[model samples]
Target chain A: MTQATRVHVAVPNAPYDVHVGEGVLQGIAAATAGADRVAVVSDREVCALHGDLRRHGVDAPMLEFDGGESIKTLGVLEEVLDFCAASSLSRSSILVAYGGGTVGDLTGMAASLFKRGLRVIQVPTTLLAQVDASVGGKTAINLAAGKNLAGTFHQPHAVFCDTGLLGTLSEAEYQSGLGEVIKTALIEGEPALAQLESISRDLGARAVTALSDTVARCVTTKARVVVSDPEERGARRSLNLGHTFAHAIEHAAGYGRVPHGIAVAVGLQLAASASERVYASSTDLGERIGRLLSAFGLPADLEELRSRYSLGAALTANALIEGLGHDKKGRVGAPEFVLMRGPGDIELGVMIAEEELRDLLA
Target chain B: MTQATRVHVAVPNAPYDVHVGEGVLQGIAAATAGADRVAVVSDREVCALHGDLRRHGVDAPMLEFDGGESIKTLGVLEEVLDFCAASSLSRSSILVAYGGGTVGDLTGMAASLFKRGLRVIQVPTTLLAQVDASVGGKTAINLAAGKNLAGTFHQPHAVFCDTGLLGTLSEAEYQSGLGEVIKTALIEGEPALAQLESISRDLGARAVTALSDTVARCVTTKARVVVSDPEERGARRSLNLGHTFAHAIEHAAGYGRVPHGIAVAVGLQLAASASERVYASSTDLGERIGRLLSAFGLPADLEELRSRYSLGAALTANALIEGLGHDKKGRVGAPEFVLMRGPGDIELGVMIAEEELRDLLA
Candidate 1:
């Protein structure tokens, strides 16, 4: 694979760079030039794959642990921070999130805590992370009571998406990634949705290209929203399209049990259905969304599917509806949901009465 | 007892406010805008004093532990984060860091990690914290290898410096705080330094006016630096006038044995000595700096300080001589030390060779 491509993410007050492509690990030294040290945070899996990258003169010590969203607890973040501290990673050190979303989230947080916010670079190895988690500048860990209850919206100086890392993912994991790709495409515009629908068959070479294009497109969309509303103060709420339901699914499943993209895919279906029921969207459009998910082997029947998964009754439909009340958009005294009327058409759905929510779930 | 007597700090980004007064605990709810869920990270001592603050508002589950710099570990940060997650603190919820620097450091960090950075308000109840730690937006926990090796520069939305809390502090802790006040005064200007020096004698009723003025001046000095260079990029380096040697002293004495401010006092004395030795200034100025520290009962001897402080032999001498080598002024391929030629007069000290460092230290 070619050397990882480097790209700088310009955050108004804090400017950082993102290194892409492959063999980017070798460039870590140069990437972290101004940094006095580097603290490489990763889990067992990614460390096994690219652990050697620490020697590239990054000036940071490589710290690894068993990785999983389930383990994305405050405990793990603290451990990673201790490792960074033990390594003498100063404020000038580059904290590299060297795994998937879980690693990225925790590492980013560790950087934020070291000296009250140090230079951090995201090295996202998962397609889900590259497309969604790594782009938004949000870093967090899960708690027993909920998913992502603790986190910060500190953006990274750079994000490195080495597509070559896809070589290691299981098919299930790769497919899990497609869920976000599809979500992004639908959120983009009519062109993206039509393009996705047209390539239902043979998502092999065409699939990779489509997915990559969709990720870039989604990145641009999320970036615009983030730039405009870095703290989710206003327009950024639009990016939560299906996250409301997804958070519930992830929380109900107790994190890690449901891959983020899979949960997001389920969330999309719920949003589609909720749109039909609450916003009076075309019912046919909701059914079409199910078909598209089914075509991609994604779970469309979220209720029935919950039984097959590790779903917590407390966190599922009931908790999700309640949690939406806590979202920033809920400030208007209602959970304004993001809905899809049709392919590439999304609008904010008004909050349904609690009584109506129970009926819709039923 | 008047509400206006409270010490308040406002950070612009979150439009953050920190209130430090006799009954600031009652203000926590008001500061947080009545968020239903609250995550409070504090050590045993702080929790005891304001544990009831949790009951003042909603059902706020308090997370308490030992209060000290060493406890500002990743383990503590994680535990607090776990509490936030377990409690289902939403984006709308607020986190209160209820303690001194360590508590503020970890609490701010945990807040930053929760939901990718939550709205956090710091309630600093120590003189050291009130005038310095509570204002500049620096937060972190110490690692086994050194002090604040892993952390972030996440600013608190608000800071509370409850001067009433000072009534609970021991004389040693109170004097330690003076070290910071002195540092701030020296950097602020001649008027501030003189005022601070006068209050250093009797921090009682007669000196209350001087103390308040000193605190305000110090806070403004830090606030101004943060505003111009919040991330310690350029002008902020001025704030680290005594930190190079202070860090070494803290490291050498171990973390908790010697308070941060006390070590900073020693560091200040050393910095003055370095200034006289390196810049050819008269040793009389260094003696004056030493006498000023002694007036507040702060240690001026470099080797006699107590704290779990350790240093990479090179760092002990190099970091001070090099001004930590991370400041923006150090870009000339040489360490630029921020040194004072005389009281109220500061200049960038050029990088000296390692061989020359031993002579200066001697």
Candidate 2:
């Protein structure tokens, strides 16, 4: 039994706590202690595997759905809301989202839209969700125009990252989460970057202590960023370091074709390479990140990613550029990229021309 | 030309100005100054009559729909988002919500969800929207379960309450706006209540100065309430004075059948009567409010309301009580009602038993 690490997120008007450890799912009881009613919204597989909340002393009705990027749609969102209505969930009720990022996103969105807003407790079962998606208030579902095109910034009431649940993840799924871990390390500066590099082997082996410590660190870093800029007006854009390109890739490749974090992994490399071209920073930075990603069984670049996944004819520079046009972060002119001058030294909203981007991709 | 009164709403993270006066729609250009592009979402009839943004120097594309309670649905919300995509609205672009409360609510919800959020400038054409709905950040669309069951608290960048547009409203529509005015006065306390009493005749005659001053005062009252509690967690619930019963009435009466503010007018009387029974407050208060409603050509009680509108079989006491069960503001036990002790002396979240409520309605 590993000691649980707690990270406090101080988003304005909606502060919450995140617990990370082997058996933190038990904390769901404490998180929802006073809730009039607790309803669980979860991935179908996760519910089947670990569905009994009564074992943890939470006697709540559960609503399960197939979890994937495909489920992140407005139609699915309405179904979740309908379930909430049927469950008689009031503003005083709490909704526990139990699954990976897709379940968390869909449930978080449902909680936000159901009766204006309902308090939500996130119990993330995947490493990617544990480290990143479940911490921030950014809850979204996809529209036909783009991914996460329609959503809200409704922060969770509490987050429980039970790393014990990760024991069931497939090898590819575990590596997918490490992609975000690497992205966070790059954004967190030299010491964190070095720490991730040192633990890359242990993380690859899925060591309990290594996973717990890394999840706590990623959550701490994310909490700090979210507190400063909860709405992503300025500094919060730093968290989108690899996300702009990642979203474009996901859009061009067709949603659900490639894992989100894997796309983010390739996005990090693209951002780093573009940083070298735009800022003329150390070329060594990209190489170092690539090596770390490779050590964790993740794709280090687009060419490697293409070999691993079928991106089809959509994975073109032109298609990606066109996809970039629909990015939520986009403004009046050219889409701004979160480029790195170096680790911890990130520039937000950096405009890179289409011609220059095309040349770089070529 | 009457001077436009400006009220600053200081909702944290999103603050904007509300301008109230005749012909204030001309100020639309200044509110959306540096926007990459400006797009209009408006009521179809309003657009045909006054949608020419070119005269105001805001040459933006327009999207119009039939505006009413029927349009406040997830389906219509999706159409609005699709139009935003079709119009190429980015985060930097401005969406001008130009119509009555329906248009404002739909457009504001779309603005909040489109690409996470887009800046919206509200150009409220209806008197009800001018005083209340347009100024508050609460944007919602109805669900099959209840009215405003799905929504967000996305504040507008600016509000332009063009009193000139009220000239085209039907007699019932004009009085509908007065219903909310009466509710605001009651919650605002003595001075506001007396002021409405003094100017009720001028307001009924649609005098320009009377309308401008009254709108500014209502905005000031609402702005103060919203700034203190942006998310309706505590003090803000008082703003829902007649709204609990009002929403129930609208729900039972079938949406689009009853004017929202008119339902609120009768709701105000019911709450006043409830307060008298529960708190032993003055019986004079209910009578005083009734007179004010009559002066404004509004329904003062349920009997008056039923006489004026076809409530069918839905306006029964049991049906309304059932409707209260689905209110977003409800909790675990009994649904809380926003009761009043006297003018400007409002009580929030007062739980009245089902039997007691039935007796009061009887």
Candidate 3:
């Protein structure tokens, strides 16, 4: 029997399996064996790269649209639904999203709302998707108001990621993958992060292995958190460590201008700095994290470059405040931010003073 | 102290709370208290009857659309999303569905997809919705091919049923409510079903008290099963007792033409008759059920209606076959209809032959 690495993501109802390996795309047919019809929702980039998956025994109709982070909007979802209706796809059918984070988020959501709900499988082509977006089942899209402003915690039936596809990504895209890998490392611990760092020298062989392993590791950490609090009411709030700051940067920079991982890279650094300044987390460790982010060719000084953003500080503050307000963690009142004391240690409902936050504004 | 009755529905992750009483519309404000914005997905009927819920201290932006079962299609959902976007509603916004089953189903689905998943509250108007549709976590809409073909099992945060609304329904609509009531009676057995027969004379009074009580009792039964299998893989199959035949009939006749409850009444009688014929169930009980359904002015015979339905044997056969295939109970193979031996005693996986099904077709 072939060795198939299985990553079980603990969602609310059941543990969903994520399979990552060589030629895993071929396994899409088997992963959704029971579904009578399969509608593959892919962007133009993925379709062009994969050479028309409908030709490859996918055995279902294909719905292709313009590919990009910008496509992950409610408008795109409407288009996808129209496609499903025009194709006569029913709830019994399965939807396979064949692309990166944006595609995964948008397609997962489209499949979710098609008939109220349906089964979806993620065929993540990007390294960022394989490690992060595809595993947790947080399907969503960006609106004009904010990034990931619309989404659901819908776990896919299965995720099939072929690491061979990573070879096709540009160096900038590959570095973006490392950004998430580092985020997982900082939160998860030194061991996984260190292992990924050591392999970064060789982008071809060792980097792919490191990326795949890190994806698995991040997924494991996320699955454990999700299983405990699938709705993010309690302990799962830690997963949003850098996301608050990240959302601010993404919105300020304008959507699609800031790649998610790059923005997250900056956000993670800011979070580390905040932990040090506000909560007395290890400043040295924060600097070490800063070094790793910069070493990975990501934006390490976003807090310092606050003036570069087009949006106002008050606007950024409100947007982040509004985003946090919508979060499931803010069940009580005036959504609280999670601050860290150190690695593996967190304080929930930590009120960050507006004066202190303003002082830290570069 | 206010005598606030909060019913806990046992669903996976977070079991929902159901509130029943007068001025429950006011309770909706409390449920969505902390939301940044509120989006109400209602139809014309509920808005007209409730007199623009916005007037009742619902300051949130409302998305009003066409009412009825037909509007539960994909096209309507797209329109709803467009409405949400145009209104500048963000992911943190609260979505409240105000109406009967169709409204609840469509809104629940819209919430599930909008921003991946948004918080949803159900304010059911009709009798069928208050007791049955709103209480259970099942949310779905009909497709061109089948009934409830596209959907999800999303439980709302809370449900409010104002018994006063049932006052406006026509006599035909009132009889339609009995269809589900009778179904619950059959599933719950002697105590629940016998209690039902007692209140048969004073249905109007009992509907406000005992009818809601019976529906809640049925909800309790299904809730227990749902807790074990939120995804509807195991014991949850029992709830689909009369649904298979009901779905077929509803699709055969135009959806709104034959009310859901009317189809269910006919379907339940047919199921009983089929059980007696195929699985050695009680012929006496089956006849009694037919009598009860007929007394309520439900359609017990389909011979005269056959020509009008345009239901070919092949269509019926495929519809039944495909419908069963979608049933979570039929995981191992072809879905078998649940045949009852008596009032409460149910037999699982009774594969009825097509010849026998054709023989019992009336």
- Cα-based TM-score, every candidate: 0.84, 0.96, 0.80
Best by TM-score: 2
Task: Write down the TM-score for model 3.
Answer: 0.80
RMSD from true fold, candidate 1: 4.8
lDDT of 1 at A120: 83
Question: In order, what fnat does every candidate score?
Answer: 0.55, 0.70, 0.30
lDDT (Cα, 0-100) at B86 in candidate 3: 56
Better model by TM-score: candidate 2 vs candidate 3: 2
Complex DockQ, candidate 1: 0.37
lDDT of 2 by residue, A1-362 (tens): 58799899988777999999999887778778888888988788876787656667888888888889889877788888888888888888999898999999999988998888999989888999999999998898888888888888889999999999898888888888988999899889999999998988999999999999999999999999999989888998998988888988898888988899989988999999899889865668889988988898888888787767855466888888887887878775468899998889999989987787897555
Q: Evaluated on chain B only, what is the TM-score of candidate 1? A: 0.85
Clash pairs, model 3 backbone: A115-B150, A115-B151, A117-B151, A150-B115, A151-B115, A151-B116, A151-B117, A152-B116, A152-B117
lDDT of 3 by residue, B1-362 (tens): 12334668777566788776555566766778777778788767767876766766777778777667877876676566555655555546678888878888888877765655666888887767776777666777665545675566677888877665667777667777778888777877778777776767667444456545655565566556567777655566666677777766666555786678777777787788888888664567766776676666666655423443454453354454544444433423444677788777776667888778776663
Q: Rank the candidates by lDDT, best first.
A: 2, 3, 1
Which of the two candidates, 1 or 2, achieves a greater lDDT against the reference?
2
